[model samples]
Target: MKSRSQDTAIHALGIDFVELSADRVVMSMAVGPSTHQPAGILHGGASVLLAETAASIASEINIAEKNKYAAVGLEINANHLRSKRDGMVTATATPIHIGRRTMVWDIRITDESDQLICISRCTVAIVEKR
Candidate 1:
């Protein structure tokens, strides 16, 4: 499978795909100027982007190829827990639900110290491709 890291947005945000599987997707991004908000901390949008990317990729992999389906983000909610000024943040996404119509993913973002940075849940809709 092609890694989503190759996507321009992912590359621009410095996201790196670490692992890809049907059950889980792992990725990391550096908390540098590019990802920092006005407060010099990691931006919440960056976390959300990471969460959505991981969940979307995992959903695509889990869907049966015969179905010719693609996953699109239906909804996403993120809770920022801690703040980090620098260092890399890693996100791990695991399937909460994988269905024919919809898939839900639970993602947790952690700092270098393994401290919880953000928790997110994303829902993806499976749609048939034209």
Candidate 2:
């Protein structure tokens, strides 16, 4: 399917999708010296970007026919449980709610070993084309 967001595989938000499906979505991005804020660990904004892209893809996949929704990121709450020095990070997004007006999703960012780096909850408003 064609992508709804005005972004490529990797976004200016530093989010990239590795897998996209009807029920689940996988997003990835690098976390090395270039993306760091001088401490050399993954940036918090990177984590949020991952969550946004993953949930956006899920919303795009779950919408009805002739319906298009742009993920406005109504709310995003993230908890940094751990940190990784230098490696790629993946975020798996799962559906929490798929109502007609709004949708919610939870995305967990992890390292290569499946170690939890951050957990996020995202809410997006689903609206018809104006």
User: Best candidate per TM-score, number?
Assistant: 1
Displacement of the residue 85 alpha carbon in candidate 1, Å: 0.8
RMSD of each: 2.0, 2.8
Every candidate's lDDT: 0.92, 0.79
Instruction: State the local distance difference test value for candidate 1.
Output: 0.92
Tens digits of per-residue lDDT, candidate 2, 23-78, equal: 78998888886567668887787788778778877887787753555545678889
Superposition error at 29 for model 2 (Å): 0.8
Task: Encode model 1's per-residue lDDT on 1-130: one tens digit a residue.
Answer: 9764566778889888899999989999999899999999999999999999899989988988746889999999999999989999999999999998899999999988899999999999999998
Give the deviation of candidate 1 from the true structure as CA RMSD: 2.0
Sliding window of 10 residues with minimal summed lDDT for model 2: 4-13
Task: Please list all clashing residue pairs in model 2, or write none if there are none.
Answer: none
Which of the numbered candidates is closest to the native, going by highest lDDT? Answer: 1
User: For model 2, what is the error of residue 11's alpha carbon versus the real structure, in angstroms, after optimal superposition?
Assistant: 2.9
